[model samples]
Target: MIEILNPTSLPQARETGALVADILQTMRSRSAVGTNLLDIDRWAKAMIAEAGAQSCYVDYAPSFGRGPFGHYICTAVNDAVLHGRPHDYALGDGDLLTLDLAVSKGGVAADAAISFIVGDFTPPESVALISATERALSAGIAAAGPGARIGDISHAIGTVLSEAGYRINTEFGGHGIGSTMHQDPHVSNTGRPGRGYKLRPGLLLALEPWVMADTDELVTDADGWTLRSATGCRTAHSEHTIAITEDGAEILTVAGRAQP
Candidate 1:
């Protein structure tokens, strides 16, 4: 379902977005070599509870995933890209980790994701992959505004990824997000411009641009949740939730570090 927040609820949306961004940033700081993925999940759980917020992931039973995600955050490592279920594994040096989080506070929800390298080892390829996704995400956000079409955002994102020589996957991309986590008006990573739903004020969208280094194919891990590259190539994903406004687009899920 597509949901547009009322002006009054927009404040709550900003609050929830800040909370989500802060939590993800804290988790990223705590993540390092030898840090267990389960520990990260536990940290997220504690933080969500402390903030009186609800996790949009844990207990989530979507058709694409096994029932009840049972994790506070998604810990996608190196080859893994989306829906990565937290496990007993510990992060290794130079491991590319993607943390995707969504939470509801004051009846409004925001979703965001970040990809970064763990420890002191940053491979050139990994750095490039992460940069490409971030650039694509920025492009998508720049293309979003009141009266703009969804395809315009998708096309901008696709242009960035394609130019960076990464393959785009449309099976799982960004979407409308509001009171609930995932909503309608599916936003693919790549699409033709001047097509699809026109943007309007109060509409919230989570624009994510993710890509695999080599192929567009994906293979699910044994856990039935984690989606990895079919060729086991490294992947990167970047996302943020934004609210369309009269002036343009207001980014709700800006990273805490980037905020004043």
Candidate 2:
């Protein structure tokens, strides 16, 4: 379903967005070498409850994923990209970690994701992968505004990844988000401009750009949730939720420099 937030709803949405951003930043600070994935999940659950908010992933049961994700957040590491279910593994130095989170507060929801290196060690490939996604995400946000087309956003995002020498994957991309975690208007990473849904004020969209180092193909882990690169190459993902306004898009799930 496509949801357009009313002016009154925008406040709640902002609060929810701030909550998601805070949780992600807190998790990033706590995560370190030897930190268990399950511990990260526990921290997410506790934070959500403390904020009096609800986790969108905990009960998320999509056809592509195993029913009832049963986790508060997605903890993707190294080769893992999307829908990464927390496991018993401990993080190691130089591991690329991605944290995707969605939360609801006051009946409004916001979603966001961030990919970062675990410790002081930053592999050039991993850093490049993460940088490409972040740049692409910013480009997508810049292309979004009133009277804009979804294709414009897609084209901007795709151009960045393609120029970075990464193959594009159409299987999953950004989507309209509000009231719930996922919604209509599937925003592909790459597309033609001046096509698809037209942007309007009050519309919320989660723009994510993710890529694998070598292959565009993905393989599901035995856990039935984590999606990894087909060639076991390193991966990175960057996302932010933005609201279309009169002048331009305002990033709701703002983190660091994830601003338009």
Clash counts for all predictions: 0, 0
What does candidate 1's lDDT look like per residue over 1-260, in tens digits? Answer: 77877888887888888888999999999998999999999999999999899999988998988779999999999999998999999999999999999998888889999999999989999999999999999999999999899999999999999999987889999999988899998999999999999999999999999999999999998888999999999999999999999889999986553222
Worst 10 residues of 1 by lDDT: 251-260
lDDT by residue for model 2 (241-260), tens = 99998889999986443212
Alpha-carbon lDDT of model 2: 0.94
Reference-based lDDT, each prediction:
0.92, 0.94
Clashing pairs in 2: none
What TM-score would each prediction reach against the true structure?
0.97, 0.97
